[model samples]
Target: MRRQAATFVWRAALAAALVCGIGLLPWLTRTDPALTVLKARSADRDPTPEVLADIRAQLGLGDGPLRLLGQWLGGLWRGDAGRSWISGDEVTPAVLQALGASLLLMAVALVVAVVTAGLVCARTLRLGAHRRLDGRRTAGSGSAVLAALPEFLTASVLATVVGVQLGWLPALGWYGPQWTVLPALALGLPAGAVIGRLLDDLLPGAFAEPWALAAAARGLPGRSIARQAVRRCLPGLLPNLGLFVVGLTGGSVAVEQIFDIPGLGRTTLQAALAQDLPVLQAGTLLLVLLAAVAAGLAALATRRIAGPALRDGALSSLHRPQPPTRGIPTFVHGGLLTLVIALGLPRDPLALDTTRRLQPPSWTQPFGTDALGRDMLARVAHGALDTLLLALAIGIVALVAGALLGLVARVSGPLVDTVNAVPPVLAALLVTSVAGSGAATPALAVGVVAWAPLAAHTSALLRQERAALHVTATRGLGAGRWYLLRRELLPAVLPPVTRHALLRLPGIALALASLAFLGLGAQPPSPEWGLLLAENQPYAERAPWAVLAPAAVLALLGALAVSAAGGIRRARPRTSATLAERPSLTRELVETG
Candidate 1:
C-alpha cells in the first residue's frame, strides 16, 4: 500500500506538472520577430529599423523558439513574469490581481459544487427504499450534453432572461452576492449531472454485493444500504476524479467575459484580445496551476482510498429504514432549471429605457446600457430565455446524437473505443470552426463531440447490466428477447441513463457561454454574458471590476457542477462488490469443494 501510494503520488505529480507546462506555454512562448513585425506593419504600428534592432538587442527576438521558451522558463522558476508588451507595465501585479480573482472564483465554485453535490448524494443515499431511480440511469446522456457545451450559452440565457427581461437582478454589475447567481448555476448543471450519473451507476453494484445482500436481508433497507455501499466504494472511485476543476475554471474564461465577472478568465481573455502577453501568460499559468493542484489531490485521494476498498465507511447501520417514494424523481433538478431561468429574467421585464447608448453600469441603469442604447438589464433578461432554450436544444442534440453514435460504436467494439478516445471537444470545435457557424450549429457541434463518450459509457453499462445474473435468470425462464430488453434491461439501464441526462445541463451551458464569448454563438447588440464580456474587452482596462461580477457568477455555476459530480461519484461504485466479493468467492468455492 505504501509503495502504491508513493508511485501514484509520483505519477500524479508528473501528470500535474505536464498540465502546468501546457498552461505555461503561453507565457513561455516567444513572439516570432518576423511575424510580430509583419503584424505590427499591418496595423500601421510598424517599428522602424532602429526599433527592430533595439528589440533584438534587448530581448533577443532573433533567437529560436526553444531558447526563448527556455529563458522564460528560467525566469518563471524565480517567480518573475517579464515586462508587458503594450504598456511596458510589470506583469506581476496585473497577473496577481487576475489570479487572485480567479482563485477566489474557483474556490467559491468548489464550495458550491461540494455542498450541492454532497447534499444531493447524501440525501439520495439516505432516502433508501423510497428511491425512484438512481441518478446514474441518464449519466451518459447528461454527460454527453454537458461535456459538449461551452460557457457562453448559460451566460447569454441568464443575462437576457434574468438580467434583462425579468429585471430581477442587475445583469451587468458585480456589486454583491446578488450578481453571483446566474453564472454559478450555468456552470454547475452539467458538472453535477455527470457526477450524479457516475455515482448512481457505481452505487448499485456495491449494493448488490453478498454482504450488502446480507445487510438487506437483515432489513437494513435501501437508503441505509446505499450510504453503506457508497462509503465502502470510495476507494475505487475517487482516482477517476480528474481536473474537472480546470475544465470548469477554463470554461469560466468565456463565462467571466460574458458576465463581466472580475475573475482570471475575464482578465485573461482581455489579455489575449489585447495581445498583452504577460497578462495572458500569467493568467493561463494560474489556471493551469490550479488545475494541476486539483489533479494532484485527486490522485492522492485515489491512492489512499484504494486500501481495503473503503472498509472504514462500510459499516452497515442496524437501524430501521423507511420505504422510499415510487417514481417521483427529485424535482430539485426542476428547481435548478427554474432558478436558471429566473436568474436570466429581469424584475422589470417591460421597463426599458432605450434612450442612452453604451452607458456604463451604475445605480440608475443597474445593468447599464448597451452599444445600441438598449438597457443592458433588459437585454440580459430576455437573454435568459434564449440561453435556456438554446441550451435545452443543445442538450437534446448532444444526448440523442451522442447516444446513437455511442451505441453504434459500442456495438462496433474497438473502432468505437479508438474514435471515442480521441480528443473529442477539440475535434468538434475544429469542425465547427472550419465548417459550421451560428447558434444552433455550434451547440450541435459540441453535442456531436460529446456523443462518443456518452455512447461508449452507455454501451459499457448496458452490456454489463445485460450480462448480469438477473438477465441470465430471465433468459433461463425463457423470456423473449423483447420482454427481456423492455422489462429487465431497460429498468436496469434507466438510472444511469436518467442521471446522465440530468447532469448535462450545466456543462453544456458553459460550452454555449464560451462560444458566445468567443463571438461564435451570439453577435453584437444582443445581451448575453459572453457578448457582454467581448463588448467590455476593449474597455476592460477602464473598469476591470465591471466584468468580475458576471464572471464570478459563471464560475460559481461551474463550481456547482463540480459539486454535483462529486456527489454523484459518492452515490455508488459502478463495479461495487467486485473487490469486496473476491474473498467471499474464494471461501464459497472452498466450502463447495
Candidate 2:
C-alpha cells in the first residue's frame, strides 16, 4: 500500500509539472501572453497599451504562474478545461473530439502492427526451427530495412504512388474508414518491424532454455513450444509496446499533417505554434496522463503475463541484453555500392540553369534536376555530409548523456518515463516555442528525448548485472561502489549499450529530418535532405525524381546503419571463470538472498 501510494504521488507530481510547464511557457519564451492572445484574436490591429491591458485582464495573464496553474488545475478538477485563445470555444469538446480521432487511428494502427510483428516473428521461428540459416538472415534483412524507413518519408511515397498515381486510396483528409489505411500503414510498418526484430532476438534464447528441452522431450508439438517461447518474450516486450502507444498519441505529427488528419498530435502542434494556451495545456496534460496510465497498465500486464514465475525470478533473464550478431548483412554491401557511385558523380549543387529545370535523369545528370535546375545528385551528396556529421555528433552526445544518467546517476524510472513520454515532434515544438527555430533547434529537441531509450536500456542492464555472482563476490571482498562500477559494471554494460545506441543513430537522423520537413529545422535554399523533400513534395507528380532522390538516399543511410549495428559481434571476456562458467546456484543465491 505504501509503495502504491508513492507511485501515485510521483505520477501526480509529473502531471502537475507538465501543466505548470505549459502555463509558464510564454514567460520562458520571453513573449507576452497578452500580445500573443491579442494577435491571435485580432492580427490586423496594433498592440496599443490600453488594448494589451484589456487582453491581459481578460486572459488573466497578470496572475503569477503558480496562481494560474492552480486555477487551471482547479478548473480541470471541476471538468472545465477553460476556453481556447484562438477559437474562444470550451477546450474540453475540441480536445475530446481530437483525442477520439487519435484513439481510433491508434487502434487501427496497433492492429496492423500486431499482425505484422506476429507474421515476422512466426516466420523467423519457423525458419530457425528448420535450420534455414540463410533464409532467416535474408528475412531479417528486409524487415531491418523496412524498420529504417521513417514515417514521414513512408507516408509521402505511399501517398504519391498509391493514392495519387494508382488512384486506389484517398491520400488526404479524415472522412471515413477508407482514409485510415494509408496513415496506419505509414505508422504501423516500421513499428511492426522494430517489435518483430526485438522478439526475434529474444526467441532464440527462450527456445534454448531447459523448459523448452523438457517440453520437447515430453512429446509436446513444435507449435506448442513456439507458443510458450512467445509467451516468455511478451513480458519483456509489453513495456516497449506501451511506450510506442504513448509516443503514437503525439509523435504522429508528420503523418497527421500529410494526411490532414485532425488528430491530437496535429491539433496540439498547431496550438503550440499559434500560442493557444488553453488547448495546449489540455492536450499536453492528456498526453502526459496517457503515458503514466499506459506505463501502469503495462506493468500490470507484464505481471499477469509473467504469472508465478514473477516470484521465482525465472522470467527475469528474458529481460537481459542479448549478444548482438556480427558480420555485415548482405544488404549493407548494396548500400555501400550506391554510395560509391554517388561519390564518383560530378555536378555542382548550387549551379542554377533555368532551361534544364526538372530535367529527367540521363547519362549526364544522373539524379535529374530540381525545380531550380540544380543537380539532384550533387544536392543529395552534399546534404549527406551535413546530415550525417550532425547526426553522428548528436548520437555520441546522447549516448554519453544516457550512459551517465542511467548507469552512474541511476535516475528515477518514473522521471525517465515521464520525460520519454514527450515525443521528439512535441519536444521540437516546445524548444522551438522557446528558442525560435534555428539550425540547432531540431538538434536540441531531439537531444532532449533521444537519451531516454539508452537510459532505460542501461538501467535494465545494470539491474541484471548487479545480481550477478561476480558482483556479489566482489562486494563480499570489500570492493567499493566505484571499484565495482569501474572494473565490473561499466565493462559489462557499455558494449551492449553501445550497440543499442548504434541502432538508434538512424532513428535520430530520421527524427532530425522529420523536424526539418515540418519547417522546424533548416530554412529555405538549404540542401538539407528533409528540406529537399519538403521543397519537392509539390512537384512530386511532374518530377518524381526530385522527391525520390533525397528520400532514397535517406532510406539508404538508415538501412546501412541498421545493417551495421545488427552485424556487430560483442567480444568475449578474457577470463578463466566466465559468467557462463559460474554455477546456477551462485546466481540464484545472489538473486534471492
Candidate 3:
C-alpha cells in the first residue's frame, strides 16, 4: 500500500512537470522576440552601447532558453503568470475572474447533467425489466432529444423562445442566476446523453446479476435490488463520468463563446482573436490544468472505486455461479445488445418539399426538414457518420497519446501535476485562429483540443487493470508483461473501455455538431447538422419545426447511442443460488389441504 501510494505520488509529480514544460513553451519562444523588439527600439532611444546593454541586461533576453525558463519558473512559483501586455492589468486576477465563472457554469451545468442523466439512466437501469424493453428506449429517446438537439439551434431557440419570445430570462450572460439556464441546458443535454447511456449499461448489469437474484430469493424486495445493485454498479460508472467531465471541460470553450458567457472560455475566444500573449498562456494553462485535474480525479476515482479485477471478479462470479439454475442470460443480454446496436444504425430525415419551407413535423416528413428542403431523417443519418467518425477519431488519437504519457509517468518518476498542468487545447485555441469554415475542421478542431480525455481515461484504465487480480495471478504464474497484459489485462479493461469509447461518440458529436451550428464549423453547402441549423435559425420563430426536425433527429441519434451502449449487456439478476440452490424447490412442502 505504501509503495503504491508512493508510486501514485511519483507519477503525479512527473505529470505535473511535463505539463509545466509544455505550458511554458510559448514563453520560451517569446524570449528572443521580447529581446529583439526591445533591443530594436533601444537603438532609436540611445546611441550608446551601454544603454543598449542596460536594456538587454534588464529584460534577461541575453540569457539562453534554460536560463530564461528558470527565471520564468521562478516567477511562476511566486504565483505570477505576468501582466497582460494588452490589458496592462495583472494577468492573475483577470484569469481568476474568468476561471471562476467558467468553473461556476461547469459546476452548475454538471450538477444539472448529473441529475438529468442519473434519472434518465436510472430509469433504464433500475426500473426497466430488460435492456430491450420500451422503457429503456423511452429514456434513450430523452437522451436523444438532448444529444440530437443542436446547441446553437437549441441555444437560439431557447434564446428566442424562452429568452425573447417568452421574455422569461436573459438571452446572453447577465452574470446572474437566470442567465445560466440556456447555456446549462445546451451543455447539459449532451452530457445527459452520455450519462443516460452509462446508466443504461450499469443498470441492466445490476438487474441481470446473480447477487441481485440471490438477494431477491432471500426476500429482498425489487426496490432493494435496485438500490443495492445500483450502488454496486455505480463504481463501474465513475470512469465514464470522468471522461464525460474531461470532455465537457475541454468542450466548454466553444460553448462558452456561443452563449456569450463571461467565463475563461469566452475570454479564450478574445485571446485567440487578439493573440494576447499573457492572456493566451495563462488562459490555456488554466484549461490544461483543469483538464489534468479532471483526468487525475477520474484516474483516482477508477482506482478507488473500481479497484482492478474486483469488479470483473464480482461480475464473473455472478454470471457463472457454482450452482445450477435455468439460464436467464440469453434474451436479456441479446435484446440489450440489439437495442443498443439499433442506435448506431443511422437514420436520414431530409425532405424535398420547397413549397412550404421551414414547416413543422407532418405526415410527409415525421421530423420536418430545415429551410433547405433536405430530409431531416437523411441529414441526421449523414450527420451521425460525421460526428461519430470525427469524435471517435480524435478520442482514439488522444487515447494513444495519453496512455503512453501516463505509462511514462507511472514507470518513471517525475512531477506529473506539472505535465498534466500544461494546457494543450487552451494553448492551441489561443495560438491558432480557427481557419477554414469547412465541416471537417470543427470536428478536427474538437478532436485536437480534446486529446487529453483520451489519454487520461486510457492510462487510468491501464493502471487500474495492472492492479487487477488476474494480472496479479499472471505474475504469480510467472507470466511476463506481454503474456499478462495482452491476454489478461487488456481483455478485462477493454470491454468497459470500449463501452465508454462508444458512449463518447454522442457527446463529441454534439460538441462538434454544435460548433458547426455556431458558424465556427463547416462552411456553406457542407450540409452538416450544426451548419444546417445555423442556416435555418433565422426562420426559427415562424417555422420552428423546420429547425426542430433536424434537432429531433440529432437528439434521437444521441439517444440511440446511449441506449445501445448501455443496453449492451443484460442478465436476469437473481439471488445468489450458490448458498441457496433452488431454495423453493429444495424446501418443497407437502400440500397441507
Candidate 4:
C-alpha cells in the first residue's frame, strides 16, 4: 500500500509537470503576448522600442517562460486565473459560468445517450444470434452515418426539422428545457448509436458466459438473462462513457457556436480566434482537468464493480488467438475516390471570377460559386483532395508511430502513461506554434496528437497477444521473437488496427476542419472545408449555399468513413469464442489516466 501510494504521488507530480509545460506553449510559440496585443490594439503605428518595453513590463512579459509558468501556477493555487485580454474581465468567474453551462449541456446529453442506448440494447437482446447480428449491422451502419455529420450540420438539421418545421422547440437560445432539447439530441444521438453498437457486440458473448448459462439452466426468463448479460457488460461499457464525455465537450465548440450558447466551448473558440492567451489557457486547462477527473472516476468505479474473476476473464479474453480477416473494399474505394479527385479536378482552386460570385447551385456549377466567384465544384473537389491527403498523412504517421511506440510501451509502461496524460489539444497547439499555419502543420499536429491513442491501443493489444498460450508455446519451442511476432501477433493486431484506422479518419477530418476554421490550418484561398466555412461565415445570411456546399461534402466524407469502418467491423469473421467479450485496455487507460 505504501509503495502504491508512492507510485501514485510520482504519477501525480508528472501529470502536474505535463500540464505546466502545456501552459507555456503559447509563450514559447508566439511573439511575446505584449507585442501581439500592441499590434492588435495599435496596428497603424509601429510601437517604438520604449513603448514595446513598457507594454512588455506591464504584461509581465519581462519574465522568462519558467517564471511566467510559476506565476500562473501560483495564481491557480490561490484560486485566481488572472484576466481575459479580450474582455478585460476576471477570468475565473467567466470560466466558472461557462463551465456550468457546458456541464449542464454535457449532463443532459449523457442522460439522453444512456437512455437511448438502453432502449436499443433492450430491443436487440430479444433476437437470436443471426438476427442480433443483422440488427447490429443495421444499427452500426446508421450510427456511423449519423456520427459522420459534424456538430454544426447535425444542429442545423435538428433545428430545422424539430424547431423550424415542427415548431416543437425554439430554433435558438438556451433558456428552457425546450431550448436544450435540440442541442442535447444533436450531441446525444451519435453517441447513443456508438454505445448501442458496443452493447450489441458485448451482449452475445455475455449471454454465452457460464453464469448466464447457469441462470438459464435454472429456467430464468429471457428478460432476466438479458438483464444479467447487460450487467456483465457494464464494466466494459463504463470506460467508453468517459470518452463520450470528452468528445461531447470538444464537439460542443461547434454546437455552442451554432446555437449561440455562452458555454466554455464557445468561449474557448472565441479565445483561440482572438488569440486571448489567458482565457484560452484557462479554458484548455479546465477541459483537460475535467477529462482527467472524469476518466479517473470511471476507472475507479469499473475496478470496484468488477471482481477478480471478471477482470481476469475479460483480460484473458482480450488475448485469445484468432485467424485474421481482411476487409479490402473500403480501402479500395477510398483510394479510388482520392485518385479520381486529385486527377480530375481543376489545377487551380484559387482562380477567381468576380462576375459569377455567390451563384447558387445549378447545372453549370453543381456546387455553386463562392463570394470570390471561384467555381465551388472545382474548389470542393480540390478541397476533398487536400482533406483526404491530410487524413491519409495523419493515418499513416499515427498508425506507424503508434505501433512502434506501442511495442516500446509494453516494456516502459510508466513512460507511456505519462505521455498519454498530455491532452491532444495542447499537443496540437504546441505543434502549431512551431510549425506555423499550413496544411502540413495542422496535419502534423493532429498526427502527433492522434499517435497517443493509437499507440496505447496497439500496446495493450500487443501485450495481450504476447501473453497468449500459442505465443508462450511457440517461444518455448525455440521460435524467435521476429518469427513469433510475424506469424502470431501481427495477425491478431492487424484487423482491429485497420478498423481503428478507418474510424480515426473521420475524426482526423473533423480535427482538420476545426483547426482550419480557427485559421490555424490550410491558410487563405486553400479551399479546405474548414477554411471555406470560416471565410463564408459573414456572407452566410446572403449566400447560405457557400457554407452548405462544403459542409455537405464534409458530412458526406465523414459518413463514408464511418460507414466503411462499421461495415468492416460487422463483416469481419469472428474466429474466437470470446470475440465480442474482449475489453479495450487502451480505452480504459486513456479515459482513466
- Assess each prediction's global lDDT (C-alpha) against the native: 0.51, 0.75, 0.55, 0.64
lDDT of 3 by residue, 322-354 (tens): 222223433443354344335424543443567
| Best-to-worst lDDT order | 2, 4, 3, 1
Q: Which candidate is the best by TM-score?
A: 2
| Residue 592 displacement in candidate 3 (angstroms) | 59
lDDT of 1 by residue, 160-235 (tens): 7788889987777566666777777666654554555456446545654567768767877676777667765453
Clashes of each: 105, 0, 56, 0
Sort the predicted structures by TM-score, highest score first. Answer: 2, 4, 3, 1
TM-score of each: 0.51, 0.88, 0.67, 0.77
Among all windows of ten consecutive residues in candidate 2, which has the lowest summed lDDT?
A: 130-139
Instruction: Give the better candidate number (2 or 4) by lDDT.
Output: 2
Residue-wise C-alpha lDDT for candidate 2, range 1-593, written one tens digit per residue: 98777777887787778778888898888888888777777889999999999878877778866787688778998889999877789999999999988888888888888888887687757754443423212335566667767788789888888998898999999999999999999999888877776677567656666687688778777787778888876765675677778767778999999999999988898888778888999998888878878777877886687645554433333323345555555356455636734763455678899999999988888789999999888888877777878888989998898888886422355666777667788788889888887888889999998887777666655655565555666566566677667666677677656756776777787888888889888887778887888888888889999988876776666566656665554344332254467656345434433
Backbone clash total, candidate 1: 105
Worst 10 residues of 3 by lDDT: 317-326
